[model samples]
Target: MTSVRVAGVGLTPFGDHGDRAGRDLFAEAAAAAIDDAEIDRAAVDQLAYGNFMGALAEQQGHQAPLMAEAAGLDCPATRYEEACASAGVAVKAAVEAIRAGTADLVVAGGMERMNCLDTGEATEALAIAADELYEVRAGMTFPSAYALMAQAYFDRFGGGRADLAHIAVKNHANAVPNEYAQYQREITVDDALDAPPVAEPLHLYDACPITDGASAVVLASEEYVTANDLDAPVEITGVGQGGDRLALQDRDAIAETPAATEAAEVAYADSGITAADIDVAEVHDCFTIAEAMALESLGIADSGEGIVAARDGKTTPDGDCPVNLSGGLKAKGHPVGATGGSQIAELTRLLRGDHPNSEHVADATTGVAHNAGGTVASAVVHVLEVAE
Candidate 1:
C-alpha cells in the first residue's frame, strides 16, 4: 500500500555503440544510477534487468546474474522480457516488490546492443519477440504490422500517408534539442514523403532506427526516500499493464491499440488522475503511426484526431499536452528492450526539470510514460507525480 519513488535515473547516450556489448553498457548505466542515488552498493537488495535479444544477438542468455557480477553488485537479480516493454515491465515489478515490503532499494535497468549484426540478422533476431509460431512464421515484420495499422487509420479516418508524415516531421523537430536523440536532424513532411519505403505506407523516415543503448533507475520506498533525504524524488502514483492477442490477425482492427487503452484506463483509475491532469507524457512512438495511435489510446485525442492534433502543433514540445519531448522512439532511437527504461529516464529528467530542453514542458507536476511490446500486444502505463 506504500508509494514507491524514483531515487535516481541514469542513461547512456542512445546510439550505436560499435564495440560495446549489452553487459558492458548495462554495467556502466547501473553504476551511474547507483552513484546518482548516493546509495551504497550493498543497499541494493535486488536487480531487475530488461533485455530482449541478448540470446539471439550474442548468445548471452543469463543476463541478470551476469550484469550483477559485472557491476560488482552482489544481489539477487532477474531478467524481465515483454519484448520492447521489457524495461517498463521491470519498473512495474520493482515497484511491486517494494510495495510488498520485499525490498527497500532496487536497481531496474535495460540494455540493448543492437547494431552488432547486419540489418537482416538484426531483424531476424528481433522477430523472436513476436508471436513466432503465428506471426513471424507467417512472414510479418514489425514494419508490416505497423503499416497495416497505418492503412487502417487512413481508411477509417480519411487521412493517408500525409498524416503519418506529419508525425515524423514533428517528432524529429522535437528531437533536435535532445542530445541523446539518434536523429536530431529536422525533416520536412515533403522529405518524409520522398524517403524510401521500408514497408508499404511506411517510409524510411517513419521508422525508428536500430539503436544500442542502456538506461537505469533507482527505486525506493517513500519511507526510504524520506529517511535518506533523496534529492528531488518522484513518486510513481500508478502502474498498470494489459495484454492483447499476440497475432495481428486476432485483432478486430489494426489501427486500434486495445492493450494500450486498457492499460491506460487501469493506470488512470489507480492514480485517480485523468488524461487532462497529465502535464507531459512519453508515449511509445516506435513508428510514426504508433504515436498517433498512442494519442487515441491515452484518451488525449478522439479516434483519428491524433494526426490533426499533432499537425496543429498541439503535441509540440511547448504546446498543450506535449508528448514525446524526449524525441520519442521515432527520433530518439528504439533500442527495443532498453526503450521503456529510456522513456522513464527521460520522464525522470522532466520531473526534476533538469532536461536540457527545459522549455518543452513547464511546471510539469504530473507525467505519464507508456510503452508497448510485440505489435501492441502488451502495454505498460505509469503515472508519476513530483515528490511533495
Candidate 2:
C-alpha cells in the first residue's frame, strides 16, 4: 500500500459567522491549504468534503461540487456525513484512496454554518444526529444526553463538579494563545463551576459553543510528495474507525464509549505505537465529561480514571501527555462537521513544530486524533508522526 502524508493544513477561526455560507468558508480554507502545499489548484485529483446539517442549516445540499467549484478545483468530489465525525471519515477516505493507488493528491476537509440557525433551530438540527426515535423523541438534547453520562461517570468514579472543572479551566487556558480558537479568554475553576447550569452536573462552560467554521488539509501519496519535494510533510501512519449503538440508553455503560476504544486500538495496532507513545493528542471534548470519557476510551487513562488524570495534571501540556494543545472542542469550538478536520489540522501543526501554542509538546513526534459523532456512536482515530 502507498503511504500518505499531510502536506498542508488550513482553518478559518471558529466562531459565529453570522452570514457566511459554509461553501464560502470551505473555499477559504481549501485555498489556504492549497497555497500552503505550494500546489497548483489543477493538481488536486479529488476532493472529499464533510458537512452535517447543511441542508437544514442553510437549506443547501449537494455541496461537494459546489465546494470544489468554489475552491477552483475541477475534480471528482464526494461528501461524507457522519455527524461530528464527518471530517474524520473524509480524511480516512482520502487516505484510503491514496493507499489504494486511486488518487495521488486529494483535498479533504469539512465545513458547517451552524450559526445560521436560531438557538432552538440549531438544537433541533444537532439533535437529528442522535437516534431520532429513541433519543431525540424523548426530548433529550446533547447537553442533557451528556449530562446523564456525566452523572453516571461521577456515580461510577466518585468525582463531582470540581473534577470536571479542571478540564474547563485547562482547555480555556490553552485556548488563550490559539488565535483560531473560539474562546480565547482564560477561566478559573470557580468560573466554570459557577457558570449557569445547562444541565445538572453540566454547566454552560462544560458545553462547547455553537460555531461556524471550516478546515482543510492537503494529502498526497509519498510518491507524489517525493516527486514534488513537499517540505516537512507529516506521515499518516494509522487510521481506524468504529461504531456502536446510536441511542445512549442502549449502551451497557453510559459513561464509556467502546467505539472510541476500538478505533484507537486499531489505530495503535496499525501504527505499532501504544497509548504511552503518543506525545500529544486531540480528542473530541464536546462536553467536559466527553473529554474524560475520551481519555479513557483512547487508553490514555484506565476506566473511571480520566477525571483523576485531569485533576492530577496528567493530561496538561506539562504533564505525562499533553492532550488538546489546540484547546479541544471545549474552547477551540465545535463546528460539528468541521471539528474533525480542525483536530487533524492541529495535530499536523503540532507534529510540524508550527503550532501556535507555545506550550505544545516539546519535540513531539507522534500524535493521535480522536473524533466522535453523536454520542459516540461513530468514531475515527488517526495516528500521525513527523516524517522520519
Candidate 3:
C-alpha cells in the first residue's frame, strides 16, 4: 500500500458563527489547508467532506459538490456522515483513495453550523443520531444517555460525580491556551460539581457546547509529497473503525464500548504501536464521562480506573501520556461532524510542535485520535507519526 501523509491542516475557531453557511466555513478551512500545503488548488483530485446535520441545520443537502466549488476546486466530491464520527470517516476514505493509487492528493474535512438553531432545536436535531424508535422515543437526549452511562460507571467502578469533575477541570485548563477553542476560561472541580444539573448526575459544565466550525486536511500520497517537496508531512500510520447497536438499552455493557475497543485494537495492530507507546492523544469527550470511558476503551487505562487516571493527572499535559491537550470536546466545543477532523488537525499540530497550548507534550513523536459517534455506537481511531 502506498503511504499516506497529512501535508497540511486548517481549522476555523469553533464558536457561534452567526449566519455563516456551512459551505463558507468549510471553504475557509479548505483554502487555509491548501495554502499550508503549498499546493495549487488544481492539485486536489477529490474532496471528501463530512457534515452531520446540514439538512436540518441549514436546510441543505448535496453539500459535497457545493463545498468543493466554494473551495475553488473542480473535482470529484463525496460526503460521509456518521454523526459525530463523520470527519474521521471522511479521513479514512481519503486515506483509502491515496493508498489504492486512485488519487495523489485528496482534500478531506468536515463542517457543521449547529448554532443556527436554538438550543432546544439543536437538541432535537442531535437526537436524530440515536435510534429513533428506541432511544429518541424514550426521550434520551445525549446528556441523558451519557448521564446514565456516568451513573452506571460509578455503580460499577466505585467513583462518583466528583471524579468526573476532575475531567472537566483538566480539560478547561487545557483549553485556556487554545485560541480556536470555544471556551478558553479555566474552571474548578467545584464549578463542575455544583453547576445546575442537565441530567441527574451530569452538571451544566460536564457537557460540550453546541459549536459551529470547520476543519480540513490535505492528504497526499508519499510519491506526491516527495515530488512536491512538501515540508514536514505527518504520516497516517494506522486507521480503524468499528460499530455497534445504536441504542444504549440494547448494549450488553453501558459503561464500556466494544466498538471503541475493537477500533483501537485494529489501529494499534495496523500501526505496530500500543497504547503505552502513544505520546499524545485526542479522545472524544462530548461528555466528561465519555472521556473516562474513552480512556478505558482505548486501553490507556484499566476498565474501572479511567476516572482514577484523570484524578491522578496521568492524562494531563504534564502527565506520562498527555490526552486532549486541545481541551477536548468538554471545553474545545463539539461541532459534531467537524470534531473528528478537528482532532486530526490538532494531532497534526501537536506532532509538528506548533500547537498553541503550553501543555503540549514535549518531544512527542506519535499521536492518536479517538472519535466516537452517537453514544459510542460508532468509532474511528487513527494513529499518526511525525515524518522521519
lDDT of model 3, residue 107: 95
Using lDDT as the yardstick, the better of models 1 and 2 is: 2
Higher-TM-score candidate of 1 and 3:
3
- Expressed as tens digits, the lDDT of each residue in 147-190 for candidate 3 is 99989888888888888898999999999999899999999888
Clashes of each: 0, 0, 0
Provide the lDDT at 345 for model 1. Answer: 83
* lDDT comparing candidate 2 with the true structure: 0.91
Misplaced by over 4 Å in model 3 are none
In candidate 1 the C-alpha lDDT for residue 228 amounts to 80
Compared with the true structure, what per-residue lDDT tens digits does model 1 show for residues 1-388? Answer: 8888888888888888898878888888888888888888888899988999988877899899998887778999999999999999998899899999999998997988889989988888888877888888888889888988888888888777787888888878878888888888899989999999998899999899999989999999988877888774688888889899988889886879999999999999988999999888999998988998899999888888986767877888767888888889989898888888888888988888888665666588899999999888999998998877
Error of 3 at 343 (Å): 0.3
Instruction: Spell out the clash pairs found in candidate 2.
Output: none
lDDT tens string, model 2, 252-367? 97988999999999989988899989888999999999999999989899888998777899998898888888999999999999888998899998888788763457688889
Q: What is the C-alpha local distance difference test score of each model?
A: 0.87, 0.91, 0.91
TM-score, cand. 3: 0.98
